[model samples]
Target: MRLIIGGGTLAGKPQLLFIHGIGSARTSDVELREWSTSLANGARAAGHADLVSGLTQSWAAETRFANYSDLFYRADAQGAADGISEEELPLLLALLEEMTQELGHQAELAGDRRSGDIIDSARAQIRAAVEPDAVQGQGLFAVVRRAGNAVTTLLQLPGLRQASQWTSGVQLLPVLSQVGRYLARKEPDDAGQGLDVRIRERVLSGLDPSRPLIVISHSLGTVVAYEALHMYTGRVPLWITLGSPLAMGALVLQRLAPRPPQTPAGVERWLNFWDRDDIVVARPRLERWMEANALGVVPVTARADTHGLWTHTATKYLAHKDVAGPVAETLKNL
Candidate 1:
């Protein structure tokens, strides 16, 4: 796929690469426009009116989107449900359980008894569906279906309806299946390249060595961007990760490509933003586990809150002033 949105001329401007998380199936142009609009709104809120105009008008930076979500699907598959594999089932189940438990804890801390009860019920259902004796006769698909139905039931609750709005009718299982698949690092194509390798290649292909580059990645995309950055030789002025799962110890961190995860050598500065309400974010601070590169570059993390129910969307994170201010300032300098 073409990296440049709208195939516009760069005119020797700095490049801004956006790496999206899972469940993004739209075309590159649509994704680019939506992301640019959200980023522009955030810049405007941060009082960077000039930067806002540049972003909206497509003049300040050569914006590109690394679109790899489509790669998860096959030519004949209907959707993500068809992409799920038996090997990824265990990881998916583990994440679902972890998220349910965390949400239950949060609900309890807030003294929301009803929500807590609902989350607890969901957790129990997931566990029951995945138990060894239960799945032995039912098969992996049975576990997937039962666990997904549990999430659907939880989302359908009046208390969680708002939070589930982003997903609409989509099942949480399929949305999360993308994450499990990526972390599993299994080969999806006949070429023998692992899924993670293909995704990193897609991200790296978007980088232009001749221009000053800034990378903004969210959720699973953050994982892809991090690994790709290590393979890159060009300098990156700024790298931003939003709602990342990088700090998720067993489910993610330990399974990462590079050993003893550290800041990419080419990154001059890294900023990580997360929302407390975002279930996808296991830990908000990445600097705690990551080491500084030779250039002394390490992720400076901060909390950026979002209103209503769900806060994990890339646009929601980008719209926050805390996340956008640095981006605008960096663009202004670039």
Candidate 2:
């Protein structure tokens, strides 16, 4: 897959890097180019013609994509064609346990023992939820995906919706538990030993430290991007994260490399976008968590697909003026 997104050449011009999230290992280069073009189109349509020019102008064609999904696939030796590898099964289970324990602790602090009990009960049902399908020869990933989907569906039920005031992260934890596991997995020092390290390497491969760089990461990619920025020796003037789960205290924040900081080093501005209904990102506004860090948390209205999680789609975020406007403005200023 192509890593760079703008102009065929990469001699000069500021770099705009897009890092994608889960289930995107198979996204092709052609599709990424179209996304870049779509963002430009959306910006122009929203009356940001000047900002769009920064991307399209022949002399300074500047956008790139850091495609690191394959790194995860490779680390697990699970190609996109096949679902997830068997190795991830243990990691998934372990993470599920940890997530439940953490949630229980949070509930205990709030003196909501009932909610804690509910989480424990739900945790016990996870295996039952997947065993039938796994016994039928469905891949583990498929099983987990189905289980996650089921949680999303159940959350929307009228009765369930009114049961308790579950925060977004806790409510979505069942669906996102695996993601939390991958991010928290102990990483080896060697870049090749872990998916996170490999992803960072890919993002830094073509990074010209001298030029202006803006990073746009969505979903799990935001975690990878955050760690990469911490390690990279360069200047990233702006970091735009969409549908990010970074603010999910114990589940994500504590697991990050270098830990979650007030702001990543070298970042002058951090803008985060989230659709209030997007479950993956339990916390919509990051500035609250990353307090006084010059972070801007902007809200967007995204349709909750029947499937629910698809609301985090990058295409949808890119199509919005809220997202496009800042992108154009960032490029124009650069």
Candidate 3:
């Protein structure tokens, strides 16, 4: 069984597990469960008074999708609802239904499945990505809007563009280190084996060893995944990122792990995927990931649908059309 949102897919039978990284306050695992199934949001603060019809989208931008039409339709908050607000959920679901029908038709023409398959796909992935008790692992999209904080630095904002991080949210380095270890196990060798030992001690202790693992990260989550792989000397399968912050300090984890060509054994294999013109993870990505290629790092680029829009509502089409291909193929092979 599989969940096939526009470009993303998640296994259903013997559900595949996913875990979302930390985000805003007032979020919890309970909320995430509900949101994942519904594909809703809690954004009461999206625009407030700042939303502009003309500015909602910029045509001149380079993106993965044709436009925001795909975004609005795929707006179901069907993942984690940890940081979303109470008022924003319903609106998100409406968008999901709209997007599914539209994309399903498009996908059919492209030789995928019927329109109904969109909903089925979304349903499967939502359930598999999140644990009934754990909410979810990482996802293909992430939302980052700092009304007046440093989070907006990637783009130009008034006070927000220049301010330093004020929120005590999840830091980047620790998260990346954690994810890298998971992917590192895909390869087999001394470094990979040793890293797996540490990962087992840290995360895999309770995990059912045979259960298939899939990691989908966005923004900072991407950075977390990268650092983890690098720290462990590269080994992961199905690594996906949207609007990643790979250049950031924490995600980079400079020299934390040893140089390449000397990787250890028993590490996991990998497939690193990202978007271009993601605002958060724009250029210079080729160069960075290229360095890891020597240590068995395999990276792929998944173009975005719209410029700088990091949320599911914005990138769902790309997730299914552009991003899900390699992921589904790899999972089948595994």
Candidate 4:
């Protein structure tokens, strides 16, 4: 019941729930969740249009983004940490489905189908894999998380990924999925609606009345996470935002601080993480709410992403040192 909603990899899992960031050419998280996870020679690419940047076709993009996972090798540390859980399973499956479909376009190159037919054939296979009572506990289910996504969800497909790079918009489609594309289409406020309700149902309802809850979020996802707190329940143990743009906007800060969540225990704890140069975090002049809530805070700046590091590794890695590690250590001392 604990909730972690933020840009894909920033959500860190085991119990971490990924909320992919903005992108174009959207697909459904439910549908994009099913790509071949064991990895293959010609595994497709990932990301929404924005994530892909300048790619034009799925084939070129797939070849460019060819990571080792596509070849089904051993996993990195974080990816092997945990299974994709029931809640996140659907979204991952949908992304995989979308990627596989994109890869299906290759069938046309191989002469298995026609141009338009490629999209159709891939979609059909994706649909078949997702059908209820399909191959349960196999294929995608074989691995907790496809090595790529697990890495991206927490790492945002860091630069280290080798083999092939995401070559085009079409290739990024699989990773970004329809959900990301859909978010791209919606106004920030509009997208916040569904997330708000989900927060109440998943986050607010799931926490113990007596114990405080930890809410970890990042980037644009931080906006809704705070919105949910302001509009929904008032009980939280800690609210951590990594690569958060909210810290730079005082209006946003003041709005969130007024009536924090109400846990049975006492007041809440909010640990805000920021990368100073990050455009998302903005400047010191923008922070408005700190003076309002004014709790005992530990403010420290780590490395800067300089014009927004699309990847959020700094936030996660530091939080391990400053956020989670501290929290666990503090809990231990208590």
In order of listing, the candidates' clash counts read 0, 1, 58, 40
Clashes counted in candidate 2 amount to 1
* Global lDDT of model 1: 0.79
**5: Cα error in model 4, Å:** 26
TM-scores of the candidates in the order shown = 0.88, 0.66, 0.38, 0.36
For candidate 3, the per-residue lDDT at 30 reads 44
For model 2, the stretches where C-alpha displacement exceeds 4 angstroms are 1-12, 50-61, 74-149, 152-178, 185-192, 291-309
For model 4, how does the per-residue alpha-carbon lDDT over 1-334 read when each residue is reduced to its tens digit? 2222333331212211222222222233321221111011111121122212111211111111101111111133232223233333455445545334433444445565443353454445446545665435454444333323332322222232221334332333243332322222222233464423443344334333333334555554555555545544434445556665444322334334334412113225655555422212443222344432334433333432323234333233232334444333222222
Per residue, candidate 3 scores C-alpha lDDT tens digits across 207-272 of 332334444545434443444434442234445555443433322333224333221222244433
lDDT of 4 at 155: 23
Q: What is candidate 2's lDDT per residue for 32-82, written digit by digit as tens?
A: 676676677768866887555455442333557777665543344433213
Comparing 1 with 4 on TM-score, the higher-scoring candidate is: 1
lDDT of each: 0.79, 0.59, 0.32, 0.35
Q: Which candidate gets the maximum TM-score versus the true structure?
A: 1
Candidate number with greatest lDDT: 1
The alpha-carbon RMSD values of the candidates against the true structure, listed in the order shown, are 4.0, 8.6, 20.5, 19.9
Off by over 4 Å in 4: 1-195, 231-237, 247-268, 276-280, 284-289, 294-310, 313-315, 318-320
Off by over 4 Å in 1: 1-12, 76-83, 108-111, 153-160, 163-170
